[model samples]
Target: MSSTLAGAFGIAALFVAVLALVFAVQALRAQSGTAKAVTELAATPEPQQQAQAQAQPEAKPGTVKSELRRLSRELEEARTELRETLQHLAVVRYDAYGEMSGRLSWSMALLDDNGDGVVLTSINSRNDARSYAKEVKAFESDAKLSPEEEEAIDTLRKEASPTLGNPDHQ
Candidate 1:
């Protein structure tokens, strides 16, 4: 019963707060003309009080087209540079054998904008360690790829640019 009474009081308080807010807004809206004039003046500067804005240099005729052409050229150059860079990389580390500890064996995939690049695998052993490289083209390999190598490729593909070779990869 006490809880129900408290809930009723809480609801009444909320209703009073909402009613007060509505009245406050109405009172502000019903202010005299002088108060609104003062508010407008406070919010905006007078004509003479306006600061002299720094003027941008006027563009010459045909400059818009030329500027657009220049920007397009620069964009193409950036895309070409990105295509040559190794943008996608994934490193997979695992234990080669039950005896092997610390998971030193690793396979890494290094791909460019296109899914064309190399996969490097290092097999570690207590006695001796060896590394191998395989070429990948269009997310595939002409030569057989190990399970680790395939995993490396798949990881890089999923995490790399969704549009692999597109200009918007960046």
Candidate 2:
């Protein structure tokens, strides 16, 4: 009876040892397989992500145009600010020779805040220094302006803004 019990206990220990060895081998194989997979991935060639990004589609013409328009608007605002910083502009309009004597002067000068603008025809010969203001907001319209007036306005426009590639940039 003692011999039988000892034999049974030995067989159980052997079985447990064999099972533990099998499990250890399986664990080692799993770890090795993971390492090999990582190595293979590292060895493969891959295109540069930046180069792939550059290969993407360019902006469409309409998108480009809209962007250009936005940039143009910003530039125009900058130019306006620069001009305001440097100089001023105005418009003047009045009758040159008034036949009516002693009439109230009807002269006006459209001017910037700094009072820089062209002097128009004298409203009245009676008053030499008196000047009025003109509305310059009508520059945008479908109607045509007087040739001389338009020319003067164009001259002011040319002088008011900076050139795109001006000497200042250089």
Candidate 3:
């Protein structure tokens, strides 16, 4: 009976050892799979970088320098175009006539970086309304500017001054 009990205990110990070995093997395989996935991710490029790489093929050193120069030129051209656009603007509203109280009359100045654009004025009176447009060059107009029109242009210039804290307005 003692020998039989010893034999049963040995079989139970063997079964537990086999179960532990199986679990260890499974854990090692899982760790190896995780390592392989991390390696694959490291080898892949970011989406934006991949797009840029695809758009521009590998080039010689000289070709790469020339591409950079071309890009710089395009950027400068875009900046020049933006400066030429009418981006600076101001409006002055006042009562054109003494009897008028609502201040419906307005003078608007629309200029670019170089102060080349137009000034538009609308005069409202009790009896009638009149509108006019005059071309502006270098913040001056060929036609005589009304006081309100000059005030509008002056407002834009004052706002664009470096002292006012906006150098981009220039």
Candidate 4:
């Protein structure tokens, strides 16, 4: 009986030890996660946070609301500027005529967020070179576009799309 009781006690102790080890490991993981979060928070300068906090008390609800509103306004302004700015551009080079062997002729498309801009084309040959400009609206031109001019606009459309992650489009 005594041996049996002793064995049971030993088994209970082992169980407790394993439980403690598991708890210790969980605690360490939690601590590591907390430390990482704190480090990330500290990476930002205190002055900037303080500047934001200075506008109102750190604990005030109004301050947080005001800051959010200001940030929202700034973001809208930036987006507006980005849309109005000339952000899309492309150039297409091709042979102007079948007789022209060299790809000396070229077309360039420049556009804004609304696809309002101009396409410039320069046709070159042995005899003479001619350049012309056409207005582009909503990615389409009022004047008839040559194949090269259309290709230039298509290139700009592909490049200017947000999925391209082109900084110039931004």
Question: What is the C-alpha lDDT profile of model 4 across 1-170, one tens digit per residue?
Answer: 99999999999999999999999999998778666745643564656655654665544455434444456457757976777667778998899789888789999998887777899999998899999999988789979999889998888777657623343444
Q: State the weakest 10-residue window (summed lDDT) of model 1.
A: 47-56
| Candidate 3: tens digits of C-alpha lDDT, residues 25-82 | 9989877865674554346564754465467665455543345435545766787787
Model 1, position 69: C-alpha lDDT score: 37
lDDT of 1 at 164: 78
Candidates ranked, most accurate by lDDT first: 3, 4, 1, 2
lDDT of 2: 0.48
Q: All candidates' TM-scores?
A: 0.55, 0.25, 0.55, 0.51
Over 4 Å off, model 1:
1-72, 167-170
Better of 1 and 2 by TM-score: 1
- Could you tell me which residue pairs clash in candidate 2? 91-110, 108-132
Name the top lDDT candidate.
Answer: 3
lDDT of 3: 0.79
lDDT of each: 0.77, 0.48, 0.79, 0.77
lDDT of 1: 0.77
**1-170, model 1: which lDDT tens digit per residue?**
99999999999999999999999887777555436544543465433223311233433545443344345457768878888777789999999988989999999999987889999999999999999999999778888988999999998778655677665555
Candidate 3 runs further than 4 Å off: 1-70, 163-170
Residue lDDT tens for model 2, 47-69: 44234325655436555333443
